[model samples]
Target: MDAVLTNFANGDILAITWRPLLAGLAQTMLLSLLVIPLGAIAGLLIAALFVVSAGLARVLLMVWIDFFRAFPPLVLLIYLYFGAPLLGYEISAYAAIAVSFTLNTSSYFAEIFRAGIEGVPRGQWHAARATGMSWLQSFFVIVLPQGTRAVLPDLLSNIITITQLTALASVVSVPELLHTAQLAQATSYNVTPIIAAAVIYLALLWPLVRLMSHLDARRYSTKLSAAATQRRRRQETADE
Candidate 1:
């Protein structure tokens, strides 16, 4: 472990695989940019379906969410990469990766959105309706604003998850960071450089995680302060 850690920081190991590693990093970022929004939108729709509908729609949506969430992303990757070629639609490893990540991301995003939407106070919806807003208007005007803030931290956290998950692309022969590291290791028989790759992942994700946490804390504090001020003003008005 010490040797791996030492080799990782030595800077010599990185020189050999820099090209592939950089390419992998680009692929990973591109994949994330494509998937995150797609997943968020799909998740929002599913959350809305669960929220607004009744009976069969709700059941079906729940089942759909469950099914996808249960599906391992690697299996999905294989199916998309291998199975699609059989259907006469040949996809590159990069395209297959984007699709698999998007689908997998959609499942988790749906749940995060559902939780955030559910967290909204019931009184908010009722108040919006009292103001003559339709359900859609109320959702856009009231529910979404609050719900989005509530979910921002979770959503960003999922981005971090997606970054780590991109490593799985190695199995599909996508030249992501891990895949490149593996190739270099295979050739060099040096585990040190692979350690460097692992450090790169950690270095990339740690700051993201920290930033998200900081934002969450700041937002929560602001909300609490605002609520407290509102409550105090109401009490003063009532006393007067």
Candidate 2:
């Protein structure tokens, strides 16, 4: 019992490592902020291309998404950080992380956005066009909003996934949360810093998980209500 406390829950080690851990947390948050928006915007552009493209162009987009999505993000990061210099191109750790995460997470976000855009009713597009809206205007004003709303829960879930994935940034010694914890652990010869990092991660992500759950439930309930309304309308038409 005493050994467990000394090894995993020691107050002294926590005190020693708190500053590094906090700095690491800040770095993690910054990384998340940069990559999340980059990935989302890039993915949105990719998805928009998917909507307007077909034949060879669409095939190329598919290849791009599939290749990146299939590739391991860690290897991608390592390659960009280490192998780039070998090829005469210097890249910082943060830049490597940004590029790697954007590639990986953009593929994921592209797929999500594609799904959401497809889920929007075709009638909405037709209606918008009938009102003299250009294709781009209709897509942006009418379809995009509904599509995004329809998949808001999924988007939030993906954002949560991306946030967690920021931990992988530590692999290149970016000194994000997990990397800082590992360094502290090595120096202190104790597991408490690692445990503390875990607790911090849980603290950061647990609320997002709960919020995703709530959004998902609300989405489900809304779908059920819409279905019920449609059934009632059909029954009334039959009676009439």
Best by TM-score: 2
Task: Report lDDT (CA) for all predictions.
Answer: 0.83, 0.93
Candidate 2 off by > 4 Å: 227-240
Model 1: colliding residue pairs: none
Regions more than 4 Å wrong, model 1: 1-11, 215-231, 238-240
Q: What does the lDDT come to for candidate 1?
A: 0.83
CA error at residue 228 for candidate 2, angstroms: 5.1
Range of the 10 consecutive residues with the lowest summed lDDT in candidate 2: 166-175
Q: Write the per-residue lDDT of candidate 1 for residues 97-167, one digit (tens) a residue.
A: 87787778887888888888888999999999999999999998899889888888898998888888888
Q: What is the TM-score (0 to 1) of candidate 2?
A: 0.93
